[model samples]
Target: MSFVESRAAIAEALSTVEGVTGYPKRPTTWTPGDAIVLVEQIDHTLGVAWQVTWRIVLLLSGDEGVAIEQLDELLPLITDALQPLVYVDTATPEAVQTEGGDMTAVVILARSE
Candidate 1:
């Protein structure tokens, strides 16, 4: 599939996760609760196809402690949801600060051909 089509498919796949609120193509406005943001990290041309590495960020809202706990709960679900479509590379916990408050993000690296 083309890059745009590939990304759209990834977003559609992520939409099926039970606890996820939404999968946004870009990180513009923050959603009220939990949401998934997809960012294209890198791309390599593999002859006729391109291998794209995507940063699947799970934005979690609430207290730091609770958000960390929630990351543990949600990481596997996100990975499972993406398994059939992409190769999950790594998942890491991150702390993000916004004007509103502190938030947590589980940044997952996934590769798609």
Candidate 2:
């Protein structure tokens, strides 16, 4: 599935769980070689629905090196919040350098039922 579709599915599934109210998409910014898609979900429990955010990033192979360690920092929080219904099964980041720069990297965010 595409990154946006995967993000939406994760948010929607979380909304169906207990104390969940709704999931809304969020704005994201990145460089030309970077793409990020985010979704925010709110759950009403303890008198207020908690907000949970999920992000998927896609980076392409570029001439100059690019760093996205910041995403790694926030991943734990996302994993912790979506404990019950959503989880990130796999994350693979690679760099491919060819004669014609023929390389691309995919970042997948999966949520299970």
Give residue 93's error in model 2 in angstroms: 2.1
| Per-model CA lDDT versus the true structure | 0.71, 0.45
Could you give me the TM-score of model 1 versus the true structure?
0.80
User: Can you write out model 1's per-residue Cα lDDT over 1-113, one digit (the tens) per residue?
Assistant: 76667667777777787767545476566643455546566555867766788777777765778777777777778778878888989988777777777677777788988
On lDDT, the leading prediction is: 1
Tens-digit per-residue lDDT, 1-113, candidate 2? 44456556555544443333223353242232333445433344565434333444444445333334433543454456456545666556655444555344445454432
Give stretches of model 2 more than 4 Å off.
1-55, 58-66, 94-106
Q: Judged by TM-score, which candidate is best?
A: 1
Error of 1 at 69 (Å): 2.0
lDDT of prediction 1: 0.71
Lowest lDDT sum, 10 consecutive residues, model 2, at 21-30
> Each candidate's TM vs. the true structure?
0.80, 0.34
TM-score of 2: 0.34
Which pairs of residues collide in model 1? none
